[model samples]
Target: MSEFKQLSRSVQGLSVLVTGAASGMGRATARVFADEGAHVAVTDVSADGAKLVADEIGASGATARAWALDVGDASAIDRVVGEVAAHFGGLDIIVNNAGISVRVAIDDPAYEDAWARGIAVMLTAHPRIIRAALPYLRKSPCPRIVNIASTEALGATALHSPYSAAKGGVTSLTRSLAVELGREGITVNCICPGPIRTAITERIPEEHKIIYAKRRTALGRYGDPEEVAHMTLSLCLPAASFLTGAVIPVDGGLMARNA
Candidate 1:
């Protein structure tokens, strides 16, 4: 029999950075990784919220730390990424899950501002974070970058041009970087979450949410944040080495439905 080679499916002892981890999918992602034995950096613009998540993870006997990070601030991004790498001693994976809702007509006076902020947080921050973490990530056995896009990147909704544009950019960036970093064994992937319950969607009327899910999703129900988080985790596994540049939709089959 040929010798069997071993590959790792675990992320234990790996250092992972999850942006916008105070609430929603980001928070769920952090918890999932911590549960799996990875050292999680729960960062968000909301310092208290970030601390709360880290505290919760610590209380669960998992490894985690909180950092006040505003993804839109370039200087802060550099500083925080450096601090996270320094504090953790090494960084392996980055989940760019920070995002904002920017709903405005192209003709609106605030359209430009909305577009700039949305792009800065959702699209631009991905590259900045990746670049900053490259030194550490390059030194790790498994270097993974997961950029959290949205189904809006594939299908757009009215009044969400900025959000859609940024997400689209993220998907593109993921593909381009995956190709560019392939030779180095670094995996870059994008996830487009369809209709997950998050802080952004909290204000939607429950009846409307149900109606939309029934009409638009194959599963006829909204997905949970952990569902998406698990997908993120799967891509970061060292055994997933062959998979890269893939844009996955964790929307309960929303993208599979057509009416």
Candidate 2:
């Protein structure tokens, strides 16, 4: 077989599970994978949103299904993963992209609950989902895992301590799991996005957006969700088989500013 053909086969007809696939980066990532001919399992806390995306994919003649998945719930994670894997025969790729951002200051009254919830959904859920999907992932010839971290993992910003900490934990977990799963032919990596224009950031005040565009990102503007989705898709291809334990920044040269 030609080298190009071999590389193209990597993404075709594989079973992929994308968490938080209702909107933003998750929705974009799931759509990209399905467009590339993968059977996509669209999951999110919002059942209606999940069904919408899944129905959209199904309209394109691909095998897609929506499942209600609250990553913070352990039993829901296990059950949804098992059902998706069985439905697809086995799972090949898993993207832990489900996250919530709460910007409560450390001294705020609601800080405790916000902190705990952020960690539970972002940091803790990655490993739990991975564990639940391992059996099916192991059965695939090309098993891959991508954790959606953020630029906050590499640096800190005020009023987002919990989010920053959880992302940092995700980066660490990605590296550790890559090492542990290497022997199993399962590659793991994480992507740190700088500032993507999504529903999550739509609430940022215009002044803050202006400042971020001027100084924080080298690109001088926010990125599209599809930009991040493209990088995520590349990491799942056979060409990226040798790439693992990598903390790649999809952050428009933000990380490169100092490095």
What lDDT score belongs to each candidate, Candidate 1 first? Answer: 0.96, 0.92
Q: How far is candidate 2 from the true structure (C-alpha RMSD, Å)?
A: 2.4
In the range 49-162, model 1's lDDT, one tens digit per residue, is 999999999999999999999999999999999999999999999999999988999999999999999999999999999999999989999999999999999999999999
Off by over 4 Å in 1: 1-4
Residue 85 shift from truth in candidate 2, angstroms: 0.7
Residue pairs with clashing backbones, model 1: none
Off by over 4 Å in 2: 1-9, 205-210
| Cα TM-score per model | 0.98, 0.95
Q: What tens digits encode model 2's per-residue C-alpha lDDT throughout 133-223?
A: 9999888988999999999999898999999999999999999999999998899999999888888998998789878776867787778
